[model samples]
Target: MNWQRYYKFFNYLNIAEADYFATPEKATQAISTYNRALRMLKNNKDQTEAIKLIQTIADDYPMFPEPSHIYGIHLAEQGEYKEALEYLKRVSLLDITDEMANMLQEQFVVIERELKAERSSARTQTQKTKETPQNKKASLGSVLQKAPKHHNKESLSKSEINAINKKLGNEDPSDLSEEIARENRVSDRRFLISVFVVAVLVISIFYFVIRPAVVNRLDGGQTVNQLQWLENEITDRAKDDPEINKLLNDYLSEFSDESDK
Candidate 1:
């Protein structure tokens, strides 16, 4: 079933608006649909229907400010001037481009004029609410603007500003103390890190280079070699003793003669 067309035909707002906002091209199609709905409503005097489509136009594609402004103008056309102003004000606050802002500003001027005309004529001196025709619902904003001057100043009084200051009080010194404590903790960490790195360097030198060299000497790297040389010197010194020389020569000569024969 072609749900979009069917839903649109029967004014099924929820169902018909689904796939219309899936992508940019689809958003364009949706915008066109919204435009058509607006035109049809204006021609047929269906203000309620037009507002619904205008709402959908902004809702479905909020990234584009064009739809938002158009929707606002449509709302204003339907005598929902306050709501229209809110939508346009939101567009301005959203950092929309200058061109769109200017266009909407012009449109607002026209709507504001229309609203002023209606609010001035909506009430009777008999305190009776005079019925407004299609486009004269007394724009709430315009009525408030044109209402008799009220003296309640918008600016805060000096006492009120002082009261606000008293309510705020001074910033707690405890927070500053806590911040200082945090900085001290960070400094402690840095000191510990430096100490740990130096300790590792010292330990590495001892184990890999210093300890190994000491171990080599103690385990007979050069000590045993020097002992052998000393032994040869002692034997040479002993040869000068007559008895020791006779005994060494007799034993060696006997062993040598036995081996030869």
Candidate 2:
């Protein structure tokens, strides 16, 4: 069985099975399986099984939009926004309905906003924590600088001497500062790792999954609507991430030349 036909039907275009598939019986069977998965998803008792079934379908039929869409929604509802966004972005490569497209766009906006807010809050808290020790050190230094250098020991009140000793006995400000800096470094490392993982995932999906489908479509001399959608998505995303713009633009230029022919 030529699975590419099924891939094109579910990914590139939403055409009738009779017109799109060489074997209508196989297509019908796939659709039946998809429906069964959907029904399982609707049943609260079968949710875990439903997700496994959907994931199996997705793996078997790479780039099939419906399973990705369902899984994306499920992930979002579970508060796993980053993974949800990735799955939804995959769905955008397919010929999904306008409703699905709209939902994808909304999810993108929400996830981006959530991530931005989280980063902002973390930075603010870190900054405040880092400043606190510095401010205390500065205040202590100012007090020492203004103190009389030659004051007679007996001239100091007992309360004043006790206060000075109490301040000195507290945890060392330098030690606290060092700990905060260490924590910041660890946080920075973790953030960089997260970014690297996400980047690798995006690159892998583009190279291993989407790239093959695109080459297959081009070889078949099919419409370039899906490619156009991808170009537009990249264009919009490039506004926020300039790093990937040049690579994607270069590829799109090649696609444009081929489509023109």
Candidate 3:
């Protein structure tokens, strides 16, 4: 009466001795007895056992119609319509009884229709998502973000201009362009003023500090040379006249004594 236990015992025996189920008649008889016991079960354990037993039979005898038909219906009950459809379609092609084949064919058609509807609904939702302006805008942003690094300065400027235009919405681009131009002009003027101030400082240092020191050194050298030439001329004239020489010597000695003091 415990069909699940009965199926499990036979399943284990068959595994231990593959020759036990070597004959088609023996396999068919075991499957039929298992199905009868499964119908008697009325508990949760029975439901679980039924699923396992049916799946095992389907796998063991892939060409068997009864097991495949039941397994397909079980899968359909579990909301696995696509998988159920495949098994049921296989059963229909296995040359089973006309009544059983017709039943499986009906189930297959219903599952196929449901799958088609689900696919259609999904496609419609996808199309709507693609057509949305928000999605389109996001896609545009993605493309711009993915732009290559080879872009030139002019392209960058144009992109900036376009971004500004978008941000301003209905405002004039010319006004913004003019404003930027004015700011640039101010920056240029500040730069020029800085250069001019530095140049003036350099010129002032050269004239007042460097130039004065150089001129003083040149004048000192010229004066020393002229004094030496005058002293030489006086010595020559003194040698020719004794009185003049004495007078000149006395004056020179006095000058030297004064200079020493």
Candidate 4:
């Protein structure tokens, strides 16, 4: 059977004869819940409950795309880009209208731009951190180069040594070396921390954003089998209802003939 045609036919039937199937009531409830959540967001109220409600509706009613779309938008507005991308990706898997598809594409672009900006910022920070220690080392070298030059002598006189130590805040030369080493260590630690944070963001973007799209593309046959199973279940449930059984048989026969041709 042509799974796309079967899905579209059922979808049209559900919309045209809302009272005949259970989907109309569910859709109504989903819309009501979504509207309530939207009001909470617009009023600037505490959004904890509102977020929870929308998330629940999105999970429970996968056939409806609006809840997921709105949830993704909200997350994106809050700067939760990774989660927003994930929710929006879910919306793509559902039956969406042309307008919804356009909106979804815009959202994907926004999320991608944000992720790229974050990655750029992270790299800049890491570069600055790594440069700091080198700059400090250069400054220290310049200070040492200004030391008084003794003619053909490897060692400085006592007075000259005292002057040099006083210029260095009375710190011993060995202490100065240790202080520079400590500063370098601190800078290294900061650089490592920045690199770790950037790594985590890259991994999250790949897992939540890229991985789902690839998996969905590879699962076409699995999706068709799922639809077929749903059709069988509906047929089994309608065995005692002559009207529903007749309608199912008629559509099935019609589609089977089309598939043959």
> What lDDT would each prediction earn against the true structure?
0.65, 0.71, 0.69, 0.74
lDDT of 4: 0.74
**Candidate 4 worst ten-residue window by lDDT:** 1-10
What would the per-residue lDDT of candidate 2 be over residues 1-261, giving only the tens digit for each residue?
Answer: 121122222332222632233246655555666677676555445777877877776655645678777777667767777887888888898776787787668768877887788789999999999999999999999999998887545867666766676688855454467789999999999999999999999999999999999999886665567666777888888888867788688887997799899
Which portions of model 1 miss their true places by more than 4 Å? Answer: 1-53, 60-63, 123-261
**TM-score against native, each model:** 0.30, 0.41, 0.43, 0.42
lDDT of 3 by residue, 1-261 (tens): 121232231222232232243376767555664555356332345676777776777777776566667777767767677898888887777766666756666676777887898799999999898789888899999998998766544655656776777787955556478789999999999999999999999999999999999999999999989978877777888888898788778878998999999
RMSD of each: 22.5, 51.2, 12.7, 53.4
In candidate 1 the C-alpha lDDT for residue 239 amounts to: 72
Candidate 1 lDDT tens digits, 124-233: 53235334432255586678888887588657766576566667984445435878999999999999999999999999999999999999888785787786686566
Give the lDDT of residue 190 in candidate 4: 100
Per model, state how many residue pairs clash: 0, 0, 0, 0
Off by over 4 Å in 3: 1-37, 40-53, 73-89, 92-186, 208-210, 232-261
Clashes of 1: 0
User: Which scores greater on lDDT, model 2 or model 4?
Assistant: 4
Ranking by TM-score: 3, 4, 2, 1
Q: If both were scored by lDDT, which would come out higher, candidate 3 or candidate 4?
A: 4
